[model samples]
Target: MTFTAAALIAASIAPSISNAAVKSEGMKVSMQLAPTADARQQVLTQSAVQFSKEMRRLWIEHILWTGSYIVSAISGLEDQQQVLSRLLRNQQDIGNLFKPYYGDAVGNQLTTLLQQHIMLAGKVVDAAKAGNTADLNKYNAEWHKNADDIARFLAAANPSWGFKWLQDMLYTHLKLITDQVVARLKKDWEGDIHAIDQNEAHMLQFADVLSDGIVKQFPKQFQQ
Candidate 1:
């Protein structure tokens, strides 16, 4: 499912909006003609496949870096900040994916939300490390609230992404993260490894849902 250089260029330059021409006030001039429906559909199909692959790659990186951050942070390792920086960048990358179909503002908004999600998770890790039960409970609650905010934001953007379903998916993702953290804290090495495996699989599924919804909602933006 690789795109050739020409195909990549075509997708890059394709119109973000629909092909329909708009009329100016008191003017009857026609704009540039659009591709035929058949041609447009073919381009969209190719682009959609590529988008799915990209989404999967991004989500895989998200979980892998997050796991790395978790390990570094919990063990008081020096690379914690570096792993966290990479993980935060992944959030921005995920947000940028929406800019083609939505816009920069929306993309930035998603990036902010996702970064907050990561930061809050870090707080949770810190609390757990310090044996601060009160802060752990507080940060955990805040973390779930951030997840809710993310689900709501995405559901608002695409009708295909139902709020409840997105919420449940996000909550499950949080639980998986929590599982890994708890397993690490308790010296349950097997459980931590299993949690990482589950988290990767779950994030991939999450990526697919988002990719499918975007394709279904704005087929034109995916032109090859």
Candidate 2:
């Protein structure tokens, strides 16, 4: 698990900034290129603390939204609104994490966009609970649109500070959830197999988006 966590953390860093320059800086800066094992452990420990704090906030939103549509909740999802509420809380949880990377304005803007998405997604959950497929589709469309808007902001920022490795980790986690969601829903309902297949394909597409972003922005990291 720590290896997985570390991989995710490593992936987020902005790919060695400027291979030759960063390497040169890294060498010349000499903040302590060599450290005792204890010192290295301490650094890793601090990194893990910060990483876990951010990841946990992400986990909260993931659990709330994704869990809402899980098979168990299909019958009577009274907590549909609660899921959105949890999302707001999750937003606050990760507020500080964003500040170090994006400062106040961008961080707040991103948070606002995320909250809007949560509100729209909440409507989808509400529609689903009511068995209103048409309304669910409408809300889903809005949700996707919001997602696209958020992606644009992220792309504009291009957050090169190794933040993307975390995205790969997140994408991997999302893939797992999508796989389970499709399998569980298929078993629990008689929905079209084609829909499940499409959903799975979409998950792959999303992963590709993340991968493409990483490779395009940080080709050197890929080489490494």
Candidate 3:
């Protein structure tokens, strides 16, 4: 990729702008050092796309297996800490991906929200396992509330990622997970399979939505 004359000029000019503007707008003068403008754009665009891909893969793994792990733990077939540790690591990985874009402070905030989500999910699993209907109801509500908070945080960071859409998608995610948990508890094999299928499809779409939002919001950085 070769940097065009115009790109070189713009990149050079960016630094002379105010420090606050440079930080807030994310002017990437270094990116213009690439052989071509498209090369830099490709790197950034692909990174954003891969962020969604990695997150989707991680969450899909959670959706597919976390419930089963919880079931096993509850039945004394597995250790609950193993599941929590794995999910926590995954959440940290997801959070780190955002650090390049949002910086450490905001990235850690996202990680904390995500950690809470995983913890609330664990509580839901425990309540269900114990067959404590009241606790089950309470934890389930909290889990969804955490999802709302996550959605709000994301929407605040990137207005192009609509609050309503993210909220709806995240709520749908929680509902699908709930369906799977309920089905498994009831031994409804058909329902469990259906919920898994729906979740896999929906989760991929959610990832795409986030990726698209990033591309749309930062078109200048992505355009060749």
Predicted structure with the largest lDDT when compared to the true one: 1
Model 3: worst 10 consecutive residues (lDDT sum): 20-29
Q: Residue 173 in model 3: shift from native, Å? A: 0.9
Better of 2 and 3 by lDDT: 3
Query: What stretches of model 3 exceed 4 Å from their correct place?
Result: 1-52, 219-224
Worst 10 residues of 1 by lDDT: 27-36
Cα-based lDDT at residue 7, candidate 1: 31
Residue 34 in candidate 3, Cα distance off native in Å: 35
Error of 1 at 53 (Å): 0.7
* Model 3 per-residue lDDT at 165: 61
Q: How accurate locally is residue 179 in candidate 2, as Cα lDDT from 0 to 100?
A: 34
lDDT, candidate 3, residue 33? 18
Error of 1 at 134 (Å): 0.9
Q: Best by TM-score, which number?
A: 1
User: Scored by CA lDDT, what does every candidate get?
Assistant: 0.74, 0.44, 0.62
Model 1, residue 125: distance off in Å is 0.7
Model 1 — TM-score against the truth?
A: 0.79
Q: Each prediction's TM-score against the native?
A: 0.79, 0.47, 0.71
Q: Encode model 2's per-residue lDDT on 19-57: one tens digit a residue.
A: 211123212212222211232122223444444444444
